[model samples]
Target: MTAGSSPRAVVRRYADVTGHAPVMPEWGLGFWQCKLRYWNQRQVEDVVEGFRRRGIPLDVVVVDFFHWPHMGDYRFEDEFWPDPEGMCERLHAQGVKVMVSVWPQVALSSENYDLMRQNNLLIHAEKGEDIAMMCWEPCTFVDVTNPDARRFVWDLCKRNYADKGVDAFWLDEAEPEYGTYDFDNYRYYAGPNVEVGNIYPLEYNKGFYEGQLEAGREGRIVNLTRCAWAGSQRYGALVWSGDVGSSFQDLKAQITCAIHMGMAGIPWFTTDMGGFHDGDIEDPQFKELFIRWSQFSCFLPVMRNHGNRSLSHPHADDPSLAALDAPHERLLKEEGEFKEVVRAQDGSPRFYSGADNEPWSMGKEVEAILVKYITIRNKMRPYLRELFDQAHKDGDPIVRGLFYEFPQDHRAARLSDEYMFGPDILVAPVVQAGARSREVYLPGGEETIWENLSDGQIYHGGAWQTVEAPLDVIPLFARQGKDQGLRKAIQEASA
Candidate 1:
């Protein structure tokens, strides 16, 4: 790479070393709905049915963590998830795909723990207790660095999920987040944690990718993960910013993060639409933040909404209550035995839950705003297909910095809040709260023209213009000379 090399040249060098980015699955290019959880089989099905009744376009509905009996039980709990196959069949019948969450930590009470422990397939603590992570229960991470361990976990997933019509996996806790960040005390199969920690997410995705391929499933492997290393893109890893706060500052950080992730060679990136933590659904302030974040997310490579929305009523019926009452209650009951309770560092039993995060979970006013953007995202599918094709064939990022497209535009080099959704569309999301307008910079040659998608106003390129941005408006513009079909789609959707 030369000193003044162009952005394309820099990205090309990255691809040459890491391999071209995976072609995004068509379903992935549409709207995906997720939250902290959907507790039982019926709840999951009802949510999918709700989307249909509401006329919302949902391509994927995720079953977040704790769908299983234990943290490490690869299979669904027979008690809560009475009919996995039937649930998947019903969802597929509705033209929706299912994505199940899988974590790297295996609890000591898990059925597979003894076998993994005996085979040295779990990470070990070099000092004090043997626990490598302590979430919900004392557990250790699977040594994904070991090929045999990867096969073991993948085989379990294949038998439990793939055979039951599950379309993808959410590889959560890919960071192998420890209860404490004592990197010096942990040891992995490859080496110590600090020495090889960054590679965990890559191998985490690989385990599922290879498993899907070996099972003869032909569709592209797309797995949602929390973190990624350099070459994780080759394994079809869609990395999202992890457990962010619900604030305007956090939302602004996501834009810069997405741009840098693309520059770093991982083009598949998304964020929790309304941050991941402390978002009270009933708070007027929080609702405003959620609306703004949702608008920004519409232009990302993968349009998905996820977070732990704060709940006002915690006593809602949930399977997790049983686990919280006695961390080993369900597991011990199934095994015909009894054990002591598992408590977190704070002496209280570890329990987690979030409020309803569906399109209608909030009030109708918020619901209307979410539905409008989701409809626009769905309408742009034809344009998205072309964008994904370009990404696959030329290593072009679907969501990139303005500088990537206009390397010579000196002003573009510093524009971080606005970005190019692709070569044709410039997205200027309102990152601040209570802002009714925003200034947008359109970059191109002298002959270029820019058309505003919201009001159909046209402007000459290589200049700045302030645009109106109401609650429902995201400042989006199309470069006039290219992709007329895409331009028309934006116009129709805005209309």
Candidate 2:
């Protein structure tokens, strides 16, 4: 319970107690393209090519979960990802970095499972069948709580992934997302799950952070993680809201969550810019939701687009998937068309990939809007870099609630729908479906002037103004005499 004269001051004091987030790499500040799964090497490359071909600025492309032969393989399946080093090199040549998904689950069939079990490097089930989760297979988590276990996993990752030119990792399922939240059944090197479960994510991130540092990588390391704890920011963890449903309500919830996460001392926060589940590419409603979400995401610490689209099935009988036939037969023989445990002979789950979630996949109109916001995000890179610096040095949030910048204004404290992007820009996102115009409060006295970024109008602070928000526009105002470059970016985006 630290208090200061202002919210920023309180944040600084809180950060001093919990530790500040790492200075994010410039690439991490740019737009990241991802989906539920980029199933193979060609698909990942194709998506990057698609972005480049359209002149969209993409900084990172993620290889989501189940790219390997099995859970806990810590390496890509050669059958699917034949030339890891070459693929990374090609992506690097195109100026896009690769982030591979890594889950904590180690299935019973994993090559290293026996070794890990012998060394007690896997999380132990104190009772029952020793399986921690049963999503695709009966599996146990690597005991990231133990120093030795952390080192063991990191060593495999360094040898297999780093050596193959992977730039960063998507540390998925960091909460060790159990099949059931049966905390008492699990035990870690640190303690029983009920006693020490909260620390799991922190240690999960710490292992990679420390391992990267030991390998002589500095300053540029950032890992996308699903969960985080008190000091996870110090370990270069960029936390995103996990597995969120696609809805207007979820979008509204993200605003509050971002503010709360920053106040909790984790300055780096992002959400899947179109939500993670049930967003259909062809549906007009989803397109509207995605457009609004993309606008909001442009102001976030990291701008990312990801989701699993409805009716976009990977096994839709396309000839391109012909290579998967033999594997599918083997999987069916093993699991008998029970899609839940769709595994390869090597025990890796052959999960179905979602529909194409690229910006262009969402029809031309939505594509244009998404590209516009992505361009705006690209132009704000300098401003974002500074915000990240402040977060690293002084623990300021990149996405600030109205109260964070205007502590004395009681009305500002109550505005959750609108927020500040750093100290300069005030963003009032269109949160409701089919709402064309909404009221915005420009806090501060008459001396404070606000420049309406949308139509280049002017307003005095401490006044409520109704702003028109078409499908293409988000209400933006740059604080007069502050971040003039932000206004320039907005102009450039429109241009």
Candidate 3:
């Protein structure tokens, strides 16, 4: 917390193979699951070739939960993947990096479980027993708060980073919870064992961040986790809201919830782009949700197309939603549902409340709105980079509410979903129903320039702009003279 503290070094005391700070300039895209078989030597070549063909800036490809054949047995599938080292090396050659997901609970039947269990490397309750598995495994959670446990996880990473040439690891399902087990007297390494809801994920990622620093390398090291804790930011970890269902309200809440997380020090966060819960590859609603958010996600820090990827295409067979926004996107045979206006094929249709509040099944208008916002994001990469730098150096978010930046404007506090990415831009996304237009409150003295991302319309500062924001466009504004206000106000103020 001091001026001289090495954020990286303080973090390194906990993990296995510490490396350097992230230095990569390009942003990345992630997915919810990864397929092990299709990721073999020859298969990876085809995958890399596919990305090159799409011309997508596919820098980091995530190999999520699917990579693990079973719990604790963490090794490449030799029969299916004869050469993982070769696959990674080839992906790197194609300018694409590999990221594998790792869970904290080592499976009881895993090849590596005995090594950890016998050494007491897993998390134990305060009563001093190994933490029981809740969701993903039959093993206990690792006590990340412990030194030995930290080293154990890091050692695994070292083998991956140095031996297999994996670019990064996505720390997944670290949300430590207990099932049907009642006693709150759970164990921890040394700290007081508390009924911590989701702290393990944070510790899991923190351990990895430390390991990355010790390796003396500086590239964007990401921890795409399902859970997190305070100070997890220092570890370069990002959290997506979790596996949610495909209800329209969930989508609306995601926007506001993410804003809240950003204000709480997690500027780099998003949710299941398309809802994540139980729909199959053929769900029409799911398809539309994917396209709409995939377009919206283009503007976010990390882009990922997750959920049930085993299907050949996500409702691409349905050409129903292709009226307004299908003009520029890569509409595959399975990806066309998001291009037009249509009704949801399933789910509680009542969730589609209004213009911005409607689900993808509402129509093409919403999809168009998302597409327009994405175009703006692509154009503002330079500015996004500026905010990312602030996040790295000073914990500033790429997006934030107006009050955090302009606390003096007491009125700024009310705009929860509407926030500024830094000192320059203001984003007031629509998150309610039955509303064709919305109200925007501006700071009294600050100058703003609203360059509509959907259309190139520019609105001047000093007043609220009652602009028409069809479902396709969120109200976005840039402060015209943000720096000048500070300089002028400080004419006589000094540090």
- Among the numbered candidates, top TM-score falls to 2
> Which candidate do you rate higher for lDDT, 2 or 3?
2
Off by over 4 Å in 2: 312-349
Ten residues in a row with the worst lDDT in model 1? 331-340
Per-residue lDDT of 80-182 in model 2, one digit per residue for the tens? 8889899999999999998888899999999999999999999888888888888677898999999999999999999999878888988999998888888
Task: Please tell me which predicted candidate would have the highest lDDT against the true structure.
Answer: 2
Residue-level lDDT tens digits of model 1 in 1-495:
322278878786777778666777788988999987676788789999999998889999999897776777799977678899999999999999999999998999999999999998888889999887777678888999989999999999989999999999999999888889999898889999889988988899889888888887645679899988988887888889989999999998999999998888788889998999888787788899999999999889888989877654334464545674553442222122222232334454423445778989878988988888888888788888887777666667778899898998898889889999888889999988899899888987677798887777899889999999998888988887554354565555545
Q: Work out the TM-score per prediction.
A: 0.90, 0.93, 0.71
lDDT of each: 0.83, 0.87, 0.55
Judge candidate 1 at residue 420 and give its lDDT: 93
Per-residue lDDT tens digits for candidate 3, residues 440-495, read 66654435455543344566644676756554445555554443232221222211
In model 2, what is the error at residue 181, expressed in angstroms? 1.7
**Candidate 2 TM-score to native:** 0.93
Q: Give the lDDT ranking, best first.
A: 2, 1, 3
Candidate 1 Cα misplacement greater than 4 A, ranges: 1-4, 313-352, 483-495
